[model samples]
Target: MLPFGRVAIIGLGLIGSSVARAVRATMPTVRLTGHDADPAVRDTALRIDLVDDVAETPGAAVIDADLVILCVPVRAIAAVGTEIAPDLPAEAVISDVGSCKAEVARSLAAALPDHAIVPAHPVAGTERSGPEAGFATLFRHRWCILTPVDGTAEPAVERVAEFWRRLGATVERMTPDHHDRVLAITSHLPHLIAYTIVGTASDLEQVTESEVIKYSAGGFRDFTRIAASDPTMWRDVFLTNREAVLEMLGRFSEDLATLQRAIRWGKGDELFDLFTRTRAVRRSIVEQGQDDAAADFGRTHD
Candidate 1:
């Protein structure tokens, strides 16, 4: 049986449009309805025929949906939940694609007290945005974490899991708090570091901007790619998951200080050991199929 016959996606950004495309590719008979706050985005979605229907309002999008996935910023979840609450079907399962889960759970619960809220975070995306930037295979081989609060019906949670599985994602469940902490270290902190590094490079007075661009190495180029992610989305992610992010940041700062001291004191053995361990981590990620081991991260050069 199909997990959901009718689906509504609120927000037509990269994730939202990708979901629409994935659904169409994997489950052609299932109906898809989508809405975005920006009229230009809505027009683009319509032009691309991204969904079966492009709704003008959040409520309208979910009026007949069996599943409504909010793809908006974490800070906007509560408002969007409230907007769609009135028209949401009684048995519809509400999920989201936001990275932060604890706050999303609280926001959805407050906005729609009677609904089944299963917050999800798809651990996949490129440094791209907008309806036109999506692809049907974005979720293939990715992990989608579902954080369903206590008392959420088992069937509803399973349905959400099955939905993701059909889209070629491996689904796993975690507590909202645990999900926040794990993602804080694995995803959020990395983005934060990337943004900081890229920003610092740009603000250096010793190097001209054009010179920095001209001499950019592989590491800095990768950081710049991450820093190019949507500012609004990253801003909300940092704010919504501040506690965990801050905790992780503190730990990172201490580790960085240790590395700094090692470099200053000529502790070659200490630095070598740390680098060896970190290199193993990269190898492990590749072994687990989470990343490519191809030369230069699978990039092609002419």
Candidate 2:
């Protein structure tokens, strides 16, 4: 059974468009409408047939939607909620794809006090953006975390979870605060570090951009990929999830200092042991199917 008969998606970027594609792929019987803040994007969505219809405004998009998924940036989630509140169907379910769940949940709760807001983060995406970058298989074998607050209907929560499952995501439910803290460590901090590493590299290589490009084949390529992610989306994530990010960052700094000391003091055994342990962690991730051990994220394995 389809979880939602009529679905509307706000913000037609990679995630939003991907959701549309996945929905059409898995549940062709459901009606899909989408809206973007940009008219150009709307045009492209229509040209590419990204959704059944492109709504002119957020208000119009969710007027008859049984499920409304906010795929906007973290900072914009609340405002988008306000924009569609008047048009949101009385019994419609609300959800979002924001990285920071706690803040977004609070914002949505304040905006739509009567709705069942189920904020979710599909731990799936590439360092890509825009409507054209989406694909139906983006969430395949990935995890989707749901953070439904107290008072949200159990049936509504399950419906949203089932929706994600149909899009090829394994679903897990957690409190909004815990979801934010966990994502800060697992997703936010890693992206922050990737951006920093790429920036630092570019700064140091300013005098010789050519050679930096030459050596990029070794390791810089991956950092560049991560750093290539959409700027606006990542910016909001860090700002809204600052508390959890900073907490994880402090621990990271302490660990970095320890590693530096080990290297400086020529503690070969300590360095070797740490490397071995970390290597096992990577192997375990591959074993669990979170990633593949092959190069190019198993893309080239074929």
Candidate 3:
């Protein structure tokens, strides 16, 4: 059964496009309406048939939608919410794909006031962007966390959870603040470190751009891939999730300093113990099906 009769998507970037494709693949009968702020993206979405209809504006897209998913950046959610509020159906559920949940939940509630708001974060993506980068299988076996605020309708939350499951995602519910703090360490901090490391490598006097690219090891290369993610989206994530990100970042810096002192003092035992423990963490992730045990993270075609 289709959880939503008519679905509206605001934003036509990778995640938005993926949602469209995934929905079309899994629920061929559901009517889809999509609107992107960029004309070029709207055209691309139409060219590729990403949605059933390309709306001229946010308000137009959600005119009669039963479920509206905002795939815009975290900072823009409030503005988008306000934009669509007038045309939004009274009983329509408003949700989002923003990584930062706490602020977004607050923003949507403030902007819409009377709508059933349930914010979600699909903990899935590639180091890619644009409408064409989407795939129907992007959310397969991945986690989609719903951070529905207090007083949200129970059935609305359940419908949204079921919708994500239909799109191939495993669903979990968490408080918005807890979601933000957890993601700060799992996602936001890693992206920040990647961006910094990749930037530092580019500015190194001894290493030319060509040399850096040519000698990029798997570790550095992976960091570069993550660093290459959409800057605008990540910028909003950091700005909105600043408190949690900074807290996690401070802990990370302290740990780094400890490692630095250990290396300088020839504390091989300390290094070995940390590496061993970290290796076990990786093993646990693989065993839990969070990642593949295959070499190169199963990128190889073997």
Q: What is the lDDT of residue 152 in candidate 1?
A: 93
Clashes of each: 0, 0, 0
How many Å off is the CA of 106 in candidate 1? Answer: 0.7
TM-score of each: 0.99, 0.97, 0.98
The residue-by-residue lDDT of candidate 3 on 128-245, one tens digit each, is 9999999999999999999998999899999999999999999999999999999999999999999999999899898798888988864788899899999999999999999999
Give the Å error, residue 62, model 3. Answer: 0.5
Worst 10 residues of 3 by lDDT: 293-302
What candidate 1 gets wrong by more than 4 Å, as runs, is: none
lDDT of 2 by residue, 135-239 (tens): 999999999999997899899999999999999999999998999889988889999999998777777744576777788978888888878999999999999
Error of model 2, residue 263, in angstroms: 1.5
Rate residue 105 of model 1 by lDDT.
97
Leading candidate by TM-score: 1
